[model samples]
Target: MTTKERHKVLVLLGPTAVGKTRLSLELAAAYNAEIISGDSMQVYRGMDIGTAKITPAEMMGIPHHLIDIHDPQDPYSAAEFQEQGSRLIEEISSRGKLPFIVGGTGLYIESLCYGFQFSEAVADEAFRKEQDQFAEEHGALALHARLEAVDPVSAAKLHPNDRRRIIRALEIHHQTNTTLSASHAAQKKESPYDLCLIGLTMDRKILYKRIEDRIDSMLADGLVAEVKGLLENGYSRSLVSMQGLGYKEIAAYLAGELTLEEAVILLKRDTRRFAKRQLSWFRHMKEIEWIDVEGEQNFSENFSKIRAIIAGKFLSGLEYTSEQYN
Candidate 1:
């Protein structure tokens, strides 16, 4: 299909705390678009402070989709996000408004953009149980070492603590005699829409500082209280939602596994590592138009550059309804 015949999608992606939220609202208003969240953690209810979820006031009256749609116990995956995002794109486009996806969850955003077809490897429950037993008896690292022997690429991508994904990767290799990385590489990654992928980047030092400051603000805003509430309300510390970046560290502190200072340090370190990983993922995607905001604190100038890039990509003029940002 020609570009004109395809549906248009505008995506703003970056590492956490890289100013995507502020820019998303401005772009949404200027392009007369509705926003769809691309973050994995933001979908859960009552995960506001840690996820840095956009408040209703922060939304500035723009319609945002896929936020607070699930309880903490519910499972959400990239496949589900792809399905919902595709449907939302269609619905939003049908209404003569642009569909804008804004967040930093690389896998979910990439899967939706490129229509990634997940592997069809059937579950091997016995193998899963065996791996669980191994991890329980030996350690997560030992199980991870098994994957490192067979699929080093996947092992590198997964954290040592991410036992579920590590086991799942091993299961795929065990069941299909193929590594997860190979499965992904074999898929024909092609987008179903006229896509505009924008990525924001900045100097590492500055970005890391921003990350630390953001964590400090989250704590000051009662992140510990939020995690405590979740735990008190019977949310398991092992739940996927609780295992997210801010939630996990804070939960550890709440459980007395670590002191507040230790948790804060770990959270900051993990966030910096996560940002590095995010940059790695986006760098591999060839379609992204990267904008460097390094050392530039002015929002309007950065916004103008992005606006021009979008207009050039779509070959159309934006409405420019609003440009002022807080």
Candidate 2:
């Protein structure tokens, strides 16, 4: 399809605990839309509390796709996300309902929106294992430096803390004898969707408070027990799903690696750091319209402001969903 023929998509994305959930549901219901989750972990079954996966009641009758579609042990990559998400976008738009992409996984969402095509060379398990082990022996930064040597262009875009993607870059160079930067630059990819990205932000202090409180609520909602249940069911702690924020900390406590109090403290700290990384990623992206909510603003007022933004961008000044008033 041509640029003028691209499907319109609304992307609600930001750091964790930045309040994408309630607003997304309200917009979807108002616009007669279906949602496609842009979260990496939300695709895993039995990984709810830690991922902060939405409940059915919270969905409010809007159809949601690309979530709870994988077992915790299965591997899911941005390439897979792009393929699946593209299909869902077309499917939803074809039905005359708006297709909304909601979540904080930057690569998955951005690649889907911009039509990123993955290199076709199969992953070399032996090489990946070697790189991962090297990261453990040296450090993520050291591994990232390897990416810098092989593909500085790719390295420039990746965070040192993102060990996995760094490894993938190295692996790409290893297998394809071509740098990741070269592949992506060769494509010179462009936006495949007529998309508007709505990014939420707030005071750093306030966002950190929200992150801490959300972790507290996750624990109270059986985060520890959830991890315990997954382990008892024979899932490995090394699985990517189990390495998530809440799950990893609780797993450390369960393994006698840390006391419960210590684990919780680390959990909160790590999550705050993760939220920082998330914001950094989104800040680097293009075409994002930001909404910065005040600490003192009431929820209803905030929701009204959000609705107005969406109405202007998506609804073209038409009536919005007013029943639940979320």
Candidate 3:
């Protein structure tokens, strides 16, 4: 590969519990790759079990970046993920190493993949304070309705409960004199690398089953205890990381807002819904190579299929030794 032709990056994206971790490790090992996480929640430190972060033992000695890189109180956005992830991709590719972006955070992945132009609009505290005051007095729905009036496109994409993003959309419009939706639309397709977008899927029943099983595994791995520890460490339930699938439910349980049984049920249901949303997001993205993962095919077999596709597309001449994946 020549200087310009060598900048190839692989993206392995799918919904939660789709077996992305194992395959990512195998592919990273086989291709002399470094893993750059595409997960949004996994960036928070001390958010291990609930996030289902790739544990050190599971990483198989491959270097991974962007996991556990942020505090739970810190506000990490897709724009931040884009800036940091783009840098990692360039550095990894320049060193003749493949950068494998793996996880289910669709917004972060897509923004970085398409080279979305992130506005340098910083948070306007006074404007945000006014927005918050309005929300406090008028309620979240009322605040969201106000957003709908000014930037209907952004309002349509953001949920009423997402006060932060709603305020942000309003903030951007107030500070930049431009609508958030218009800025997004104005972004050009200026990706700097050749991308191989590999999507993983399975039968709906199997995928839902996997989601349930993964939730159970997370609880078994002490997700409740993890939540308690975070709260004890002064992390508030209002923090963005605390609102993630497992953490939110468990936090509610710990606060006596719900019984343990109810929390578990809610977590499972929410995770399934999240998985569906992830699929919906990916469906809207262009140029993805979808591969249906069979339920019966174990790791080695699945690895064979994925390896073949990736080799044909990105690493045409890179010879992978058998021991590499072992």
Candidate 4:
């Protein structure tokens, strides 16, 4: 493959409610690009509303891949996502179309962009059960604290409230007898793609408002009914998909653990926190061309700026450095 063919990827990424999907559709329309979703939740079927999946009508005849490819009960991981996403990227490029990856799943996007490697550690069901029981008995924070003692770097990077990752880190340490940070450091590999990463961001106040409005819209669009449907369909609360921001909060409301009003408020708060985490993850990556959406410009203007950047770097055969944009 030529240089352009090898590293020709366009990623539109930002926090939820930051207009990434809308702007990405416009860019795809302009370039006749194929979109491969980078969202984790969007891969599961029947998760449309909570995941904010773009409908077929909303796609406007633009082809999309990697959405609704699995059932919600199935487990999907970043490693699987990277493999599938890379395959889609190649397939789209083979058809002479630009492969545009768009979503708020920072880890999923980063795995593709940086080619992060997952260890060959198989899931030990017994071990996982033991850890779960320990967590239940000793609290999630205590388990995270144990991880902190062994893998301070990973612990420092992960939030204490991130029970999933904390447990995974501990599991890795227990199974491999090595810290996750060490394994992660040892597997620092270069990416196979030359990515033209476009990151959309807005003022914090504006972003918070948008997040609030989006939660309201989701509620108005029957988010509660959606979660209720999932539960009624034999889905478990412990399932990872059900633990997503809107799903879990609304599930609580349905279960009578929280009032509808309280659930909505909590959902908004959690979504904002999730967005902040997404921004933090993206900020740590140095390769992105950050576009401030609140810079007195509309989406079209901001997108034009992005298009010019991508064209200059990838299509125009100009070796533009990141410093030029900074």
Candidate 5:
């Protein structure tokens, strides 16, 4: 590949349980690439079951970065993830290996791919606590209405139920005297890398079924026991990791708020909703070349199709040995 044609990163993204991890391993093996996880929840340690983190065997001896790097109690923001993930990408590219960003977190992927600039002002813990308490008492919508008064552009874009982002925007306005929408608009003007984006999607029904099955598998694979262990280890239910979709529902069930069967049903429903939201996020990215997994014959067939696409685009006539990369 010519210097101009060489991409700094190849991103493989899709909703949860769309088989991204397995396909990413094959692509990395094919292209002399290193995998850098784009998952937000997978960054935390002890979040294995809920996050659907790949096991050592599942990784197939490939080196993966940005997984299990943070403690559950430690706060990890998108800005921090972008900084660390970008450094890893740079380091990998400098070594003549391609970096494969693979995960379902659209925001994290966008932040790294575009190099979103964060404010210099530090987060005000006291102010954040106050805001959190207010939101808790008045409800997320009421807090979002308060944000509407300050940054209507952001408030209009974000759903009131999106409390995390709402809180973040409010906090940004309070700390930096600028709206998060303004910062996002400014950041959207430039991207750090010459990006090649690959998005995988499936039929909605199949995707939903896969998500439900995955959640069922998680439960069968000791998901409840995993959360139980965390609780026994002194991790609070209010921690960010515990609030993840599967973890929260399972924890609620363990705490006697719901029966196990009800928790499973809720988990499936929430996961489907999360997948829909993920698709909505990816739909807005115009750079992506989407692959339909629903019609693919099998994993290998799908892998070959993606491999051919990448090879034609980036590796045509390159006499590189795949064995050297794997």
Candidate 6:
């Protein structure tokens, strides 16, 4: 289908601490758009600090969706994100607004962008049970190592604590004798929307410093207390929600598996690794117009470049009434 025939969707995505939130808010205001959060953890209520969730005051009256709609224990998947995001795209477009998605979750964002076919991985009960038994015997990390041996691509995207998906990816390999990533690559990535896919990047040194600073801020904002409260409320540490970045490390510290200092060190290290993996995933994705934001002191110059890219892609013929960049 032609570009004019497809629905328009704007996505702002990148690794953590690359300034996606600030840019997304600006772009949304400029284009009269509603945002759908693409982060997996931000969908859960009470995960604000760790997820760096955008606050009401920060939203600047922009309508945002798919955030705080799920309790910590409720399961969410890429398939679900695609369904809801597609519906929201149509609804927002019908209301004469653009639909924008913003976050660092590569799989969730890419699934929505390309309408990825996920049904190719057939279920294998016996294989899944065997892997589960192995994980129980060895550990989630060991099981993840097994996956890394076969499907390194999928392994890079999944966290070691995410046993379910790791097991599923392993099962796909076992049942079909093909790596899960290969299966995904085999799909015809035909997008249903006229997509403006923008990616933010920065020098690794600067990005790492920003990540460490952000983690420190989250700790100061009571990320440890938040995890403790959830645990006190009888939430299982084994729950997928509890296994997210800050929650997992803090839970470990609280459980006496690690000291506060040790947990902080581990969290910072893991987060850096996660950011690297996020970039690796997005680099493999197609059609992203990358903007290097390093050395742009106040991000004013970077914002202008991004805005111009958006305007050229989606607002070519129309006059724009954009908010002043703060």
- By summed lDDT, the worst window of 10 consecutive residues in model 6 runs over 317-326
Tell me the TM-score of model 6. 0.94
lDDT of 3 by residue, 201-229 (tens): 98889999998998888888899999999
Worst 10 residues of 3 by lDDT: 317-326
Task: lDDT winner between 1 and 4, please give it.
Answer: 1
> Which regions of candidate 4 are displaced past 4 Å?
1-7, 152-163, 185-189, 295-297, 317-326
Q: What tens digits encode model 5's per-residue C-alpha lDDT throughout 1-326? A: 46675456789999999988878887787777889999989998988988999988888777899999988888778888899998898789888888889998877898888888777767678877888899889886899899999998778655555666777888888888999878876777356676778899999999998888888889888999999988889888777677788888888999999999999998898788888878877787788888889743577667767766676656653334565332
Q: What TM-score, over all chains together, does every model reach?
A: 0.94, 0.88, 0.89, 0.90, 0.88, 0.94
Q: Given candidate 5, what's the lDDT at residue 186? A: 77
Candidate 6 lDDT, tens digit per residue, 1-326?
A: 68776888889999999998878887888888899999999999988898999899899999999999999989788889989988999999898888899999988998899988885666778888899899889998999999999999889888888888899888888877898899788877788888899999999999999999999999999998999999998889878888899999999999999999999999999999999999998998879999999854868888888888887887863335565763
Candidate 3: give the clashing pairs.
Answer: none
Clashes of 5: 0
* lDDT to native, each model: 0.89, 0.84, 0.85, 0.82, 0.82, 0.88
Please give the lDDT score for candidate 2: 0.84
Q: Residue by residue across 1-326, what tens digits does model 1's lDDT show? A: 78667888999999998889888988998889999999999999999999999999888899999999999999788889999999999999999899999998888998999899887887889999999899889987899999999999888877776777888999999988999888777767688899999999999999999999999999999999999999999999777788788888988898799999999999999899999988988888899999888644678788988988887898463465664632
Each candidate's number of clashing pairs is 0, 0, 0, 1, 0, 0
Q: Model 5 segments beyond 4 Å from truth?
A: 1-7, 139-164, 175-178, 316-320, 323-326
Pairs that collide, model 5: none
TM-score of 3: 0.89
